[model samples]
Target: GYLGCQDTYYVGNFKGIGKVYSQVFIDSYTRVADAKLYTDKTALTAADMLNDRVLPWYETQGIPILRILTDRGSEYKGNIEHHAFELFLSIEGIEHTTTKAYSPQTNGMCERFNKTMKQEFFDTAMRKKIYTDLDDLQLDLDIWLEHFNNERPHSGKYCYGKTPMQTFKDSKKLAVEKNNEILYLDYISDSQNLTDNQVQNL
Candidate 1:
């Protein structure tokens, strides 16, 4: 599964400004991020970004995403876009799930990513007046993404003195171990259930 966020920004001072919308998709598995900057955040544009940019990037990375989880955003849930996305996921045998309305915790992974992006990239760069155009913003974003994936140490108990990439690897290993334990217990439970059923039948 993966998480996504879409938000808008405005450029220039109080007198004149132009709106730029951005959407970000982060791999919940790998913590990799794909961001698109656009003049509009409509359903068509959102779908185009996902189809052309995000999915292709995932393909290149050899990440077989089984599901995509997002909030109930109008751009994602709009009829045309939602239908197209559903069909796209269906063809890939992936499921799509949406968080309950206004429940940010359900999509907390993406929310944390968004907060980090804003704090590390947007706020810092905007404060320094570093971005003058889309190209500049894209460059800064790429640099920030590299730092985020490789250098920045994630601040979380689970991260435990490792970068996000390291944390993801460790987490996956732990998850597999935990799953195996659960499976072992489940097998025991099922065996007991079967034995009880046989005794009752006798």
Candidate 2:
């Protein structure tokens, strides 16, 4: 999942505002988040974020990312940055896909996570007047990330109202069993077809 702070903020002043850009990438499997503060929304910056922050964190966790889904934002398309991103994904044999234009729902997971981050962290920062600089904001963000991953309860509940992590683990087990059944059926069908072909040859 992905989250980004638009480069505009309405400070308490009626006539004053501040522009800060930030982006985050979350691992759907582990619910871990990696965020960074950026001065611009350029494609170069986006590429750097993917390279310097997102990929490294996933590597550290030994997570094998299969796909990356994102919106059709300018920063993620139609440029050398796109090529760079594709190259990175190619090296890892991961698919990179973009959502349909004007369809935020296609990327709903990231969008919803973004809203939660803003509501839970940014609002608190603004209320407490805590962010004096980008570094300060980043520090607060790190603290909030810990709370989100370790303490916050995700919306969906499983057996006995277990948390997302627990539910996900259970789901993975079921998925493995289902996949094995499918593969076995496919093998059986193929074997029967081969036997029929041999009888026809006779």
Candidate 3:
């Protein structure tokens, strides 16, 4: 199963710089989510978000995204040049899957995260009328989302009664342990190879 996932939630144009779009991606296992506001919903924007922002962020964690799950929006579908998203994923060897139409469960992790972002973050922002522009919304969102991932307790079954940040930290710990095991195996294999070479020489 993919630990990383993505989805787009439409808020429509509000104060009218353009249509309000949020590109959200969640770590499926940990429920850690990133929600970024965009003025337009286009394939190019989606591609850039994933390629330039999301994927790079994941790379910093020492793991290439194993897969990404998203809803079937036109922004994610089209021809080669037009579908820069697919191109980028293909180049990076990240498996991309789209949810079945109307079956939100197919990408339920992201779908739920998107809903939470709306209810908890965007809705709160709008209710307070705190923002004069998208930039303001963006600023507030960054702070709220940090709290959501780090301080907010995850009630999901897989969360192990921990906050998203705790779960994510655990995931990293496991990844490091797995890497260490692989290195140990490589060392053993090299030792065996050396023994064989020495035996043949004798």
Candidate 4:
């Protein structure tokens, strides 16, 4: 059972966009991730990200996304009904779930990835003092994310010694095995950073 998760982070103001945001989406099962630099944060923008980037990628892979978990902020809450984000999920036949209020752990996977990006990618840019413009930042991100999704080892996230894309393919193969239940049990504890409230609900 592969699940998806998303989170947003402030990437600092750039020449073209003040308060630029990094919108990230990742596979809870595979650890494969994607990110986009956005000018602002809103439900419509998040929905657009899914429509334009995430879903299409998954579609091309012929992978079915089971759900997308997000925090309960207004950008994702969408009236708990037919908000833009929820409507998008409905149309895609994907479940829409929110992290428990006051609980960051419920959304730990994406949060952990966000922390990693800040350290490995954003901090590297800052170390080189290269906050020139959005295009430059995006180019840096492109290189970083390519390495992250394709080559980096994933041990903490139930992947013994494999890259994210490798884990994704392995997990899909695991799903068809006779002892499929073990795969679920194996990847269960990747949420150590989640809030207590989130742990309970999740």
Candidate 5:
């Protein structure tokens, strides 16, 4: 099951780029993460993060994002009919849960990730080069994320010192088995209901 957390971070002002933001997503179990740079923070941008990166990756892996945890920020919380983020989640059949007020631990995975990115990526990158455009910053970020997910060994409670990708691949079989078990149980239940209806017709 894909339990995930999402948060937006202020990536600071760049020379010609002005202020940039980052929409970030992290898998709670495996700590695998993805981020995209945006010029502004909005409901549409929030939804785009999942549309452009998170969901597609999960689709390739043959798993579904079961639920997502987010903060009470305007970009994340609103009416399903009017808000882009809410509507996107509704259309995708993914559950959305919000963190409790003043409870930072509720979204700790994403919070910790933001810190890591600041220290390891943004801090270093800013010192090394001047970014003139969102696309340029995004390109370098993507390269760093590739290393973060595939090369760095995560000490997350569930990762056991393996890279996020390694942990995800190692545990994917169990996730598939559990999903199959759920489907088999549902099939049995439906068959029983159908048999009861046939007997009632007699």
Candidate 6:
């Protein structure tokens, strides 16, 4: 349940929107990634990215985020009691670790993914379509991200040639064993019991 996190600013403005930023999170094990665009780079936006996307997606997959690694940027580093991002992580019981100073390689997975995203998605999409608003751009980004996680085979250390989603699914049993927890078995059992009861009543 470890993830690498980073934020990147768009090199240029959109047609009418002034400036935008991208908050990205990638599973260090499976290389599954999520990103969202925001108008400004702030602790609130950083928290929002996790609150709105990252955590929910992981929860749906029955995976818990135990820790996250990020750089010592202002948006990510701050007082745990006061900063939005820090408070959010604290509330979610996630450990936050920062990269070693001046050592970008400590978080190289996120760095490489950012570069790949720019090259494979942004550069090509910008050439083909003119985005005037962040929502439209976000929609296209979501589609691209879906393809990235579910369709594209990854060469991650553990992934070999499997797609990120496949790798994530195949590794869930190991994650559960490592954490010494059942992967939502109680909830699934409850649902199954309810279905059996309904069948009996019918």
Q: Each model's TM-score?
A: 0.67, 0.65, 0.81, 0.79, 0.92, 0.85
Q: Which stretches of candidate 1 lie above 4 Å from their native place?
A: 1-17, 80-83, 156-158, 167-202
Which candidate's lDDT is highest? 5
Go through the candidates in order and give each one's C-alpha lDDT: 0.64, 0.60, 0.78, 0.79, 0.93, 0.85
Give lDDT tens digits, candidate 2, residues 1-202. Answer: 2222211122232112246666666555444456676656666666677777777754553444557776677666565434655556566666677788888577666666677778888877878774557677778888887777656666632424444445445555554565467668989999999999999999
**Could you give candidate 3's per-residue lDDT for residues 100-132 as a string of tens digits?**
887868887877787788888777778887455
Model 6 lDDT-worst window of ten? 2-11
lDDT of 5 by residue, 1-202 (tens): 4698999999898889998999999989899999999999999999999999999989888888889999988999998899999999999989999999878678989989999999999999999998897898899999999999999999999999999999999989988787677778989999999999999999
Alpha carbon lDDT at 139, candidate 1: 76
lDDT of 5 at 81: 97
Model 2 whole-model lDDT (C-alpha atoms): 0.60
Supply candidate 2's per-residue lDDT for 105.
78
Please identify model 6 stretches exceeding 4 Å from their true place. 9-11, 181-202
Best by TM-score: 5
Sort every candidate by TM-score, greatest first: 5, 6, 3, 4, 1, 2
Q: Which lDDT value does model 6 have at 129?
A: 91
- RMSD (CA, Å), each prediction: 7.2, 7.2, 5.1, 10.8, 2.0, 8.7
| Distance from true location, Cα of 185 in model 6, Å | 18
Let me know the TM-score candidate 3 reaches against the reference structure: 0.81
RMSD of 1: 7.2
Misplaced by over 4 Å in model 5 are 187-202
Off by over 4 Å in 2: 1-18, 79-84, 157-202
